[model samples]
Target: MKHTIAEVKISYHPNRLKGAVKITSSEYAGKVIRENWNQGTLNLYEEFKILLMNNSNEVLGLAPLSRGGMTGTLVDMRILFATVIKSGATSIITVHNHPSGKLKPSQADINIYNKIKDAAKLLDINYLDNLIITEDGKFSFMDEGY
Candidate 1:
């Protein structure tokens, strides 16, 4: 008997990188993330997104990873890293929104940030920032000394 093995294929589009939005700071990242976010749902529920970026800090794309209730969402580390790796992003910025309009990183948030930062270091990817977006503004872990 013969067995067949499935093959994995990754598709990358370099053309999209032209004139892409560049993330210079957490403030700019917050603005960009907000622009791409669904305003209708910004205050309704929790949503997590990842910003895939190239070496020049130009955004490749935004990937919505998970959605949850009003207070929190789940982030799968394996899926997160896989998405970054597949996109060929040299760095990443992770963002999540709080429906309650609070700009604070809970303890859980810090734990996950540490995990992601460590993983990024291991993979040689720059973990730019972890942002918590609210209706009013954003809280950046990097800016707050994560």
Candidate 2:
């Protein structure tokens, strides 16, 4: 017997980073990531976005991955890797908001980062940083030596 299954394909336009806005520090990435967020809806839900970058760490684009309830969001590894590969990203800085305005990363957040980092490594993609954002402030895993 033969089995049939759905197939997935990845594709994107030829747009590259403009202005060469290189990410110099965690603070820089934080600022850009926060700017992509919707301030009014920030406190209402948890959303995850990845800042796609080139080999020079310049901004390529930002892709919103998932939107979940006020507490947490689900990240599918397949979708995450697919986005990076599709966009031809050399590296990525992942970020998500904490609706409670808590800047600390939960255990789940850490786990997610590790998984993402490891997977990216195998694909020859750099996992630059993982950030937890809030209205008042932001947390950078790389700054914490994670």
lDDT (Cα atoms) of all candidates against the true structure: 0.92, 0.91
Clashing pairs in 2: none
TM-score of predicted structure 2: 0.90
Which parts of model 2 have CA positions greater than 4 angstroms off?
1-11
Cα lDDT over the full model 1:
0.92
lDDT (Cα, tens digit) per residue for candidate 1, span 1-146: 99999998889766574467999999999999999999999999999899999998999989999999988899999999999998999989999998988887889888888999999999999999999998899999989888
* CA RMSD (A), model 1: 1.2
Evaluate residue 144 in candidate 2 and report its C-alpha lDDT on the 0 to 100 scale.
92
After superposing candidate 1 on the true structure, give the runs of residues whose Cα lies further than 4 Å from its correct spot.
none
RMSD of each: 1.2, 2.5
